[model samples]
Target: MGLRRLAATGVAVAMGGALVCGCGPLGADGASGSSASADAAARALIAEASLSFRYVGDSHVDETMNQQLEIKNATRGSVAPVLAFTALDKNHQEMPQVAVTTVYGSDRGGLVVPYGTSWDTLRFSGPGEHDVADVRVTVRSAAAARIPAGMHDVKTQALDSQGHEISRFERFSAVRLTNEDDFPVSVRIAYILWDQPPKGTTQQAVEVTSVGGLTEVPAHGTSVVQVSADAAAAVARNSNGPAVSIKAYNSQ
Candidate 1:
């Protein structure tokens, strides 16, 4: 998606009615000052908005390599910024970077919860190493490309060398997904392959990997795209099928 489309979806512009600041008009907050003050105040609130991430440890259980993160809106105003998480190597080198964002019906696009609200279950794939030391999370509000919507209707299949679904194959680590929208959507999916169960409720920490490639799904179109799955998780077998866990916005 382009920047304009993303912006158009995230922040809804009231195109039907032009809200012109008048020469003499009261404010919605009942203030008797300049009419533009309301709009200005709102803009100022988010002008300096920012995002912060809180690491909540990692989990490697239930065939899911869970890296829990808390997305915090530290600013006073509500904002919708795209969150990107980059895994780093021991030497602080950049590795797999996953971006958690989405574009929904008008009023939502990569829209994180409002101010003071935190969203969890933000995920991406890389080295699911519990012992890895470095990781970085960056937030950018201005961008052109956006992942359509949180992936939906994800399925899995075992394929042969010819890409034909078969009873089984050596590759038991794939997930398939299809876009369920009127426009194109981009998504990166993965399956947690090998993992080691940690003590107690802590999920098994494993080496993480995802289906490598960005998939584009056209409006109301269906195509099978394969992703990764853990072969040794005891739960996510090649034949176990594809599954997804996306934290998405649901309009009330």
Candidate 2:
């Protein structure tokens, strides 16, 4: 199935008859069927141009509350949202030393899907005695938007044969320069060879091949170029190179 822009997102919590009304009911097993289904329900509310959430399900790990929240980005553009879980004490007041764990399905903080691609699992650390009073999810433009107003930067996640997502720790990856402004922009990418840089100093890596001169990332859209296997191998040779760099041209 394709993606759909949301118009409204909701939360419904139910634990063996104890219910907190909204969205779909949480099954007795505390598993909400599938993240994709929950994400679709939350995406129904995306046209509101705000950050919304749907409480899919909840579980207890070592007495800690683990909430499965579907964060819906209802804006026209991408949103980077920060989520926090607030626990209330016996006195109905806030508590300290609270820890919130976020496991993302998208690029690790690269850019939240403009309309939410999947659900984010949030594990709130500490005892459930301090009931969770609130789950705050706030948004801002993705880091790519802060790139000097004309340029855009993004990190790519490599996937293995099994389609398992890979991170920078595993190996070199690719980048896509997008044009999200009102005006048009030109974009290109290249691979840099940094096979073992000298320690303790900043030095430019040797420039390899560049894929440039033609690709234009249209306004309000994006263009993608895969990193050649040679590029990955080159970066693998280096103990420090991040692999490839993105270039943009004719940027307004």
Candidate 3:
């Protein structure tokens, strides 16, 4: 199946549910059925032609909420799905001042998720956001596209994937992207920082911060980018070369 541009139309919901109101005995059963149908629809959508969400972790930085989403593309072609985000409170209601934010994925510009692979990226909400207990992500629509010619034949790596203190109370991670393609490609990258887990626990704590934009990588050459998030500057610089994920789009 090919990807469909979702637009604002919704098909399947990944998280959270709504309260169905009715003054009858069937009301409760109807609400339960509705929730079940939503889950089934979401699974069906993924089985058709969409990516799946693996993990979602969030942390508060200053007044903003940062979420690290691990997304997996299990289709035959690279797909960029339009994602809709809603911050929910403990009651499963939308938080104040945090309206629904929709991120579009197009054949022309947005980052495309490589088929059969999983990667992490960051999303943000708020200037004065309330406590967001959970976030709802829905796949409104998606469109698939082929990987740019040169990019598909290129080998890429992250060099200098380490952080260093640039100033007191400030640090940054500098990464140089080396592209071995014969043509230039536009790239966008993200860095994931993790919080130290509790003593003697195997749980993994993660926080992701995005700090780079579309950069053009010269053919058979390299491009350097610096990333820093004050909320986790020290962790970003001290951690073992934070996991870096870069997506390349056509530079045409």
lDDT of 3 by residue, 87-168 (tens): 6665667665675432213212265665564333333356423344455666555544334423242232333435432321
Instruction: List the candidate 2 regions with Cα displacement exceeding 4 Å.
Output: 1-49, 59-66, 88-97, 105-111, 129-134, 138-252
- Kindly list the per-residue Cα lDDT of model 1 for residues 1-252, writing each as its tens digit: 000000000111111112222233345666655555655444433422444555433432243324444445555444444444455444656555433322221122234233454433333344543333334654433111223232233333444446666532245333344456555555444333323243422232232344435555556664455433332343234333333222123111
Better of 2 and 3 by lDDT: 3
Task: Give per-residue lDDT, candidate 2, residue 44.
Answer: 33
Name the lDDT value of residue 3 in candidate 3. 13
Q: lDDT-based ranking, best first?
A: 3, 2, 1
Q: Which has the higher lDDT value, candidate number 1 or candidate number 2?
A: 2
Tens digits of per-residue lDDT for model 2, 107-173: 1342244434335444345655224443444332122121122323322234443545554334435
Q: With candidate 3 superimposed using the best TM-score fit, by how many Å does residue 17's alpha carbon deviate from the native?
A: 15
Stretches off by above 4 angstroms in model 3 are 1-48, 58-66, 100-109, 120-130, 146-175, 179-185, 189-221, 224-252
Model 1 lDDT on a 0 to 1 scale:
0.37
Instruction: Rate residue 148 of model 3 by lDDT.
Output: 41
How close is every model to the real structure, measured as TM-score?
0.37, 0.31, 0.43
True-structure RMSD, every candidate: 14.1, 18.1, 15.1
Return the TM-score for candidate 1, rounded to 2 decimals. Answer: 0.37
lDDT of each: 0.37, 0.39, 0.43
